[model samples]
Target: MIRAITGLLSGIVFGFGLALSGMMNPARVRGFLDLFGQWDPTLAFVMGGAILAMALAWLFQAQTDKPACASQYHLPDTKHIDGRLIGGAALFGIGWGLGGLCPGPGIASLATQFVPALIFVASMLLGMTFFRLWNRG
Candidate 1:
């Protein structure tokens, strides 16, 4: 229960930070995406900060004897960047460029009840469902 509470609190904090920092705003994201034309680099700092935070968290986790949470991270480490992965990435880029909402912010942005965020979250869920069904079959 404590772990679940902590996770929820942490997620709320992160989402709030994203919103306060303007990272959750589609306009800011669009500005960042318009690189070749009137490029904005504010997103670079956000990305750098996320990378640093992840690195620090990983470093601490590596040295700790106990798990970060009462859970484990079971993930696949695929070395191959195959055509499917490339195609997915390209599609993701296009979606991000067009809608300015990735998974994280798209989910978080639901609090504001914005149309773009709603559409992004809806499509993201639909895509995930399709992928799961496709993979299962």
Candidate 2:
């Protein structure tokens, strides 16, 4: 129950931050990605802020033996980079470049930019489903 509540609250805060930072805006993201053209530096500040926050979070996590809501902290164990990682990253970059929205901002934009967000999210889900099915061997 506590874990679920924490997850929900974290998601809400994240969505709110995305909306507040103009990350929910596809044009803004695309503008930020546009290097040769009219590039926007707003998302750079947002990224920097996020990195700083996560750095603080890491510091806090280092001090804790376990999570407040759980008995243990769940962390990624993988350090090896393989084809899957590279392929997924390339695909994600392509999708983000073309659509101007990644998963977080894409999900957040569902409230404000419903139609486009819906399309993006639906496509993302479909892609995910296809990947799962294809890899289910």
Candidate 3:
């Protein structure tokens, strides 16, 4: 129950931040992504802030007796960055550039009356389902 409540609160806060940051606006995100072309680099500040936040979290965790949660931290050990990872990243890049939406802000933007956002969410779920099926086969 505690974890669920915490997760809900965290998601709300994240969504609020997205809305506040203009990340929910596809145009803003597309502009941010188009640094190579028009050279809009507003997203860099957002990313830098996130990196700083993660660093602070890591510093806190290192000082603490244990992880902030009741569970142990589980980091991935998969060292191989093979074809699958590359292919997936390329697909994600294309989707993000074309659709102007990544998962978090994409889902958070569903509250707004944007047909493209809705379509993005639906297609994202479909893609996830397709990958699950493809991997299971």
The TM-scores of all predictions, comma-separated, are 0.85, 0.95, 0.87
Candidate 1: clashing pairs of residues:
none
Report lDDT per candidate.
0.85, 0.93, 0.83
Model 1 TM-score is: 0.85
Which stretches of candidate 1 lie above 4 Å from their native place? 71-78
- Candidate 3 regions off by >4 Å? 36-38
Clashes of 3: 0
Following a full C-alpha superposition, what root-mean-square deviation does model 1 have from the true structure? 2.0
Best by TM-score: 2
How do all the candidates rank in terms of lDDT, highest first? 2, 1, 3
Off by over 4 Å in 2: none
Superposed on all Cα atoms, the candidates' RMSDs to the truth, in angstroms, are 2.0, 1.1, 1.9
What TM-score would candidate 3 get against the native? Answer: 0.87
lDDT of 1 at 11: 98
User: What is the alpha-carbon lDDT of model 3 when measured against the actual structure?
Assistant: 0.83
lDDT of 1 by residue, 78-118 (tens): 78889999999999989888888888888888888577778
lDDT of 3 by residue, 20-74 (tens): 8777777776897776777557677778888999999889877877665567766
